[model samples]
Target: MSETETIYDQIEIEDFTFDPDTQLFTYPCPCGDRFQISIYDLQDGENIAVCPSCSLMCEIIFDEIDLQEYLDQIS
Candidate 1:
């Protein structure tokens, strides 16, 4: 079985880069790679941003309603 990932930080959702085209959210990882999550992942209630280059993750702080509103404004 896969091990559960641990969150390194609880950062505000505003700290991530939200791409309008791909609808993906990304944040800088200390390892120089970016941690990424998708808009659909947010809609599905996923809040963890995982770094592809390392075993690091972060919790994204965002309200469901507020997140939807923000997505609406951007889209």
Candidate 2:
């Protein structure tokens, strides 16, 4: 049987690279919301994400996600 992933274990920060010119990285979040977090705020395995679109904040420590899916949407 396939294992089920819980909300607390289904997302993560794959890419946190920032553009020096913009100093901001718009990450594609799969939680029905988009996050435009500062590159400085993005840390490996760290949660507490600040969503710019919805303006809602959340965190993720062990949330796993399909990195490619988000990468495709990110620009």
Candidate 3:
């Protein structure tokens, strides 16, 4: 199966909490742990956020321009 087929859901970037300290975006996962993706990964054009405690993964939906704007603000 493809990566797209493995995605549990599609979550908006805004729905995640951004931690400037770690530059990680996180969201609550059904498995009781958070799903996480790094800003660097996003910058590298990666959109999948994974739960470290489980097999669940989510596709993050965001615009490149919007991500840049957010990064500028945090920086």
TM-scores for all candidates?
0.84, 0.35, 0.88
lDDT of 1 by residue, 1-75 (tens): 146757889988888888877888899999999999988888898888889999999889998875775588566
- How much lDDT does each candidate structure score? 0.85, 0.46, 0.89
Residue-by-residue lDDT tens digits, candidate 3, 9-64: 99999999988878899999998999999988998999999999998999999988
Report the C-alpha lDDT of model 2 over 1-75, residue by residue, as the tens digit: 113422222234555433456645545555676555544444344455556555455443333353334434554
lDDT of 3 at 59: 94
Which candidate's lDDT is highest? 3
Superior by TM-score: candidate 1 or candidate 3: 3
Model 1 segments more than 4 A misplaced: 1-4, 73-75
Residue 71 lDDT in model 2? 39
